[model samples]
Target: MTVAVATIGFTKTTAENFFARLKAAKVKRVIDVRLHNTSQLAGFAKADDLAYFLKTINGMDYVPEPILAPTEELMKFFKTDKGDWDVFSRDFSALMKERKVEKALKPSFLDGACLLCSEATAHRCHRRLVVEYLNKEWSGALTVAHL
Candidate 1:
């Protein structure tokens, strides 16, 4: 079975559209990769709220996987540097390697799992780096579909 990788940011989507998109994508679970999931800024995407909605509305499991997130300090540095993706990706990639996420990652969990964050797009999200790193580490077997 192909292990799919999908990325989504809840900020740009409504609760209805968010669940609909996951359902449309046939996602079985959502692995939240945010460092701070309960921030008031998250609004509907707050950890508890998001989990409740995913389970009740979409019949999907919600998992908080902080290992896939960049360190708060790193994020601060990135924002301090004015949203430099190059620096962010470089440091975040190194962090994943140090954390041995590949060894910890359960391929079965990713069969229909989507990575969740707050960025509107994967272009600048560390979740994208995580997906790419896993793809490379696992010999490119993963099919990444950013939602």
Candidate 2:
């Protein structure tokens, strides 16, 4: 069976819309793929508050998997270097390969999981790269939905 994995970003969206989208998708868990989820800028997306809200609002589980996140150096390069998406994607893909995330991450954890990040959309986010890399590694077994 093909595993269904969804991706979402919290910026430029309201808490009500965020929860509503997750509920609509029937996501069982949220995998936070952010390097720093507790930054003051995170607002409701902060780890502790996110966990609480996920449970209270939609009865969903929250899991912070930093292993799926890009390194600080990588993020700094992307943000500071005028954001070259191709170079960022190439480097991030290399990082994931080096980390062997395809082997380390369990399929069960991702089957019904939603990858969470701060980008308003998946077009220019590491979360998209992550899923694409995983799909390639898994032989296209993952059906990725960008939410």
Candidate 3:
């Protein structure tokens, strides 16, 4: 059976809406793919706060998977320098390949999981790339939905 995974960003969502979405999706685990999750800008989505909320709200387990996140250099260039996405994608893809992220994340952790980042959309975030890369590397064993 194909493992189903969902992706989400917290920028445009409130605490209520965020947990509601996760509950509705029946996400059993939340994988945080953010390199930095403690920023004040994250507010309710802060690492500690989100973990607590997920457990209280949906009995979901929170797992921080930083290996799936882009390198600090790539993030700075993309987020601060307004770098090209294609370039970032290429560079980050190479990094993922080098790191062998597919082998690092356990199949059990990915099953019924939601990948969390802060972009508000999966369109141009590393979280999206991570899922896409995994889908390809895993021989389409993963089904992904951006929420």
TM-scores, all candidates, are 0.94, 0.97, 0.96
Question: In model 2, how many backbone clashes occur?
Answer: 0
Pairs clashing within candidate 3: none
Regions more than 4 Å wrong, model 1 = none
lDDT (tens digit, per residue) of candidate 3 on 27-134:
999999999988677688889998998998899999998899888899999989999999999999999999998898756578899999999889999999998998
Instruction: Answer with 1 or 2, whichever has the higher TM-score.
Output: 2
Candidate ranking (lDDT, best to worst): 2, 3, 1
Model 2 per-residue lDDT tens digits across residues 1-147: 689999999999999999999999999999999999995655899999999999999999999998999999999999877778899999999999999999999677799899999998999999999999999998888999999
Cα shift from native, residue 51, model 1 (Å): 1.0
Assess each prediction's global lDDT (C-alpha) against the native: 0.86, 0.93, 0.89
The C-alpha stretches of model 3 lying farther than 4 A from their native spots are: none
> Highest lDDT, which number?
2
Sliding window of 10 residues with minimal summed lDDT for model 3: 101-110
- Per-residue lDDT for 18-128 in model 1, tens only? 788899999999999999889665577988988888989889999999898889789888876686778778888999999999999867778889999888888888888
Q: Compare candidates 1 and 3 on lDDT and give the better one.
A: 3
- Could you tell me how far off, in angstroms, the CA of residue 15 lies in candidate 3 after the best superposition? 1.1
